[model samples]
Target: MKSGEWDRGRFVGVELQGKTLGVIGFGKIGRHVAHMGSGLGLEILAFDPFLAPHMAEELGVELVADLGDLASRCDYLTVHVPKTEGTSALIGADVLSRAREGLRVINCARGGIVDEAALLEAIESGRVAGAALDVFEEEPPTNRELVDHPAVVVTPHLGASTREAQVNVAVSAAQLVVDYLQHGKLHSPVNAVFLEPDLRERLDPYGELGRRLGCLHAQFLEGNPKRIIVKYFGDIFDEPQSRNFVTAKVLAGFLGDRCSQPVNQVNARSLARDQGLAVEEASEGRSRYFANMIRVELTDSSGERNLGGSIRGRKGIRLVSLDNYHFDAVLEGQMVISANEDRPGMIGTIGQVLSSHEMNISSMSLGRDRSGGTALSVINLDAPEIEKLAAVAEDLMQEEGILWARCLQAD
Candidate 1:
């Protein structure tokens, strides 16, 4: 009409009301489009293999098992799924051939999901009426035939090009990077780690404790970590979804010393993958000791070591178990852990060594199954300004009963 080329009957447009609108991926954006389309009286149908049937029902959208079923029933087909190996050319010649006659297609998603060549053929053959594409297989698309096609409507991929949307995307990307860099957080990670919204809030504290355990384990172990196993026990494992966040946190802590770059939940698993290290996770109904436990085992060339912790009722995070010994101590501030034989005067000897170095002991915890057997001592220090605490740890290791000692700082 703008060019005075209007052919009243030839350029007829159809109303959207009562027409079926098929959405391929019902994630964040797809659901939004479905809601808006439904408001305009268009019947909504969708296909997402991972989507629960009840969720689709709640959205007033009928869920279809496959793309073929969606194509045969809808007047308009829209692609919103991510471009992956399985989704490249997801709607190809076969899908377009089986689609409802004169079907109009829309792709506001990533490029290459719909085969442009097939779309062109469908349009020319009158199997497809027209298409509205905001994206293309190539930017500044070189194919003039499709770009100039009278039946197709094209735009310079402007799905989120509006000023507000661009600003929002920029801010979100920057924030995710900053959060991961400074505080080891990824609000929405783009990896295998998935933490449900409801579970994240409930499991955050445990995640922190799990990371601390990983950090401690890495510091205590002598050689490079070749494999790690994170085990969840008791009520926490019952939730199932809690493990992902816990595993990511454990990895973040374990890799903290291994990487020069910032280690956080987002890149932790990826970093581990790059190093060719093996990570395994398991959950059991109960722990042999604590009701709820997060245990992390590290295996290096020398041998394997276990470090476990649990959250006590309202008292916050505790160092529940270290190797075979068990005790409850706050997991914070400067502390020293020692593996030693249980014997008289061992505690006094450790305190004497700290006093000799002018270091103050704030609190102390000792755990052992039997007297004169193996034992672990965790001594919280009040001397926060001591930079060379390792020298003092070396001094403690020289004592008669003490086997090994290491200094640690936790928060």
Candidate 2:
């Protein structure tokens, strides 16, 4: 119409009815899409690691066990997962190649979920019919080829740009503020808020410790988390609210900046459970080396990671044990932890590597199981870029005697 050509043939599109719509990351938005697609007579197949099978059956949706399987079956695919390490480039070349011919992709979720390059290649190769993207790997995307493609539709990340959305967001914000002020209730808080002043005072330090430990654990985490077991040792278990509060903080920290929504102490447990993560808590009155200790064991598909911490007299919070290796390392700022063979030159080797990169070590803690065996080293660095710290860890691993190294930026 704009060109005054009136080419009716060019405007013809395929009907969505009776087509299989694959919903990846079946969270709230994905579920809504599935519901609407079902209304349109489309068969909905959802793939979410966290979603329960019964819930899918109840909604008249088939639960797909694998992403590849969903891709192979669906005529159209839409992603709705958070962009974390596991989800980044989820719909890459391999997944797209496995998808049914003429599969149309849609992404209104986060950027980087569907690999742009792969999608572009797929569209050009006729593997994918087209793509409807509301998000991109980069905002104001530089990929002009994809943007200019006649078969593709692009939006400037405006999924929540409606007038109703604007009004609802404003109302929600005002309501949250009012509720907090009048009723002392928080609906969605970015930070942890303790209602009772006395409780906050008593548990603030331990909560911080728990959060730090969680953060550290998250940095070391591999694969999808299945369960979080929090064990409280010593006098900290005396307070009735201690167990719940600290556990929440731990979950909050572990999930920091990983979830689609902001996670806080109030909603952390629920959010974890929603993602199919089982949360377990245990308490003991007896002391284990410290007056109070919060031990968290995160079990994931890869394996289990154990992290234990305690609030020392004046040290504030210290990470006491990691995977059974005992050491007193302050859980703050930029730090590098490594497992290596017990030797005289191991510490010096790490120091030399850091020195080569102009990275200064502020503090260092070393722990070993036996006189001549595997050892763990936790080194605090004077603020380096996270990327640089990761690079240093990689470099450390390449050195002699070092088995593995990991960088942690704990807040």
Per TM-score, the best of the predicted structures is 2
Error of 2 at 318 (Å): 1.0
Model 2 — TM-score against the truth?
0.76
Those runs of model 1 whose alpha carbons end farther than 4 Å from true positions after fitting are 1-198
- Candidate lDDT values, in order: 0.81, 0.84
Model 2 root mean square deviation, Cα atoms: 4.8
Clashing pairs in 2: none
lDDT of 2 at 48: 72
Clashing pairs in 1: none
Against the true structure, candidate 1 reaches a TM-score of 0.52
How many collisions per candidate? 0, 0
User: What does candidate 2's lDDT look like per residue over 1-411, in tens digits?
Assistant: 887887899788899888999998776788788889988999989887555455566677887877888899999999888887668899999998898999999999889999999999999899899999999989998868888999899999999999999999999999989999999987766555444786677688988888888888777875557788999888756665778888888987887756678777678888887766788998866765888888899887678999989987844889889887999988899988999999889888999999988998898998989888999999899998766877898899899899999888878
Q: TM-scores, in order shown?
A: 0.52, 0.76
